[model samples]
Target: MQKISQKSIHKYLRHDKKFPHVWCPGCSNGIVLGAVIRAIAELDLKKDNIAMVSGIGCSSRMPVYADFNTLHSLHGRAIAYATGVKMYKPEMDVVVITGDGDATAIGGNHFIHAARRNIDLTVILINNYIYGMTGGQYSPTTPHGDKATTTPYGNIDPTFDICKLAIGAGATFVARTSAYHAVETQSFIKQAFKHKGFSLVEIISACPVIYGRLNKKGDAPTMMKQMKDDVIPIKQYEKLSPEQRVNKQTRGIFINDTEKMEYTLAYQELIDSLKVPKGDSNE
Candidate 1:
């Protein structure tokens, strides 16, 4: 793969209009954005052919900065809008930028159904544990014992394993990586873009301002270092004993099923089947 330079990826950004992004200093959203830009640059995809869709959240602000056909949609509705875009213009590459609360909470139904249909869309779900943008509420993926503004004492809810959820929902391509692992994240995203059906990349991101301050996870660099230590490669994780695997997160492609037919193609096939022969139309 060719090395991507910061200058090269600038063309993909709306630098003049969206300069000084809204994300907090040291927020991993920027890291994810860099990975995404690098991946698109590596793929050599046209800017016009890509559509960046986002819902409400800090991560969801990505579409505002990207120069692609961007759609900043309602809370938890990025997938729904992306599905419409894909159905209407199946040729365009639709990428959804969403956060933990925005994706697995109110948007849960849309997320599952889209995966169940196996539509052609790339969903980059940034899991930052708490609802960083909406006042640090505990999200669907917040750890059971984590502290959030909503859960002052501590959370009692079990966290959702995003990759497993996607796989169970019938997404053809599912992967997980952290913002700390930029190279791996970029590689997975590239693979997701190339996949023909529903693809999800769950990126473990950091919200140092809110989630970090609440959970005492330390500064952004410390959190990133912890991620480097905690998330292991899937191959290495599989080799570990059950006891050894405790509290460890694995990063890598979890699923890539190429056999299932894409939703748009199937819909088009159904449309073609319904059409009567050219000379055999009912009078």
Candidate 2:
């Protein structure tokens, strides 16, 4: 075990002002952000060689805070932008910071296709189960029967299992953790970054102000407790009866290092094969 100082972490933050993050007190976005920063730091990745792309939402704001080659793209278009970045500079580390709504709603098409291609991109989807930045509307990942601004009568629609969505869509590496488990979240993130093909680490986070207040889930700490209590370790989850497993959150690595053809590499091969030699080409 090595020591990591607060000072070391601060160096990665945007230094040209922007003090006082706008996230509400007890919001888990900051916790998730710290896990991301720590994972990148522990991996010893060069700041310049890494690129963070994000779409519109609370979680998508991660790119603005971190010192990296960042692109704050339009709503639900982060992955599309990131795909281009990865294709153009395949050597650079490309990561997407997206919210549940941003990744699964307007962005769902891009997300699934990106996963299907098995591109070398790490996607960190922070799932607070509500649209935290946009008036706490119901989102794709919102639990069934949960109350939201848009769903005053309770969410009638079945919620999406983002982890399953990623795995089914062909993500080679998929995992889930929570802001309450910072070290575990960071661990999964590091693994996601190291994996060659598409990887997704879904962080179950807290939105105390909007989602929590609307649902009467108490303040930030209370919501965080709910996050911690909601999950069973994946190993233990397997032992539970099917009846017992309903609505239980399971943490830990679901898939690791599954082999797949990386899209960027295949694309490069295509480009190389089509390139004609300078002397062989007709004028």
Candidate number with greatest lDDT: 1
Q: Write the per-residue lDDT of candidate 1 for residues 1-283, one digit (tens) a residue.
A: 6799889988988868678888898799998999899999999999999999999999999998899999999999999999999999999999999998999998999999999999999999999988887779999988888999989999999989988999999999999999899899999999999999999999998888899999999999999998898788999999999999876899999999999999999999999998877966666
RMSD value for candidate 2: 2.5
Candidate 2 lDDT tens digits, 11-116: 7899777567778888888888888888888889999999999999998888888999999999999999999999999999999999999999999999999999
Could you say which candidate leads in TM-score? 1
Error of 2 at 213 (Å): 0.9
Q: Between which residue pairs do clashes occur in model 2?
A: none
Worst 10 contiguous positions by lDDT, candidate 2: 1-10
> lDDT of all the models against the reference?
0.93, 0.90
What is the Cα-based lDDT of residue 2 in candidate 2? 47
Per-residue error for 96 in candidate 2, Å, reads 0.4
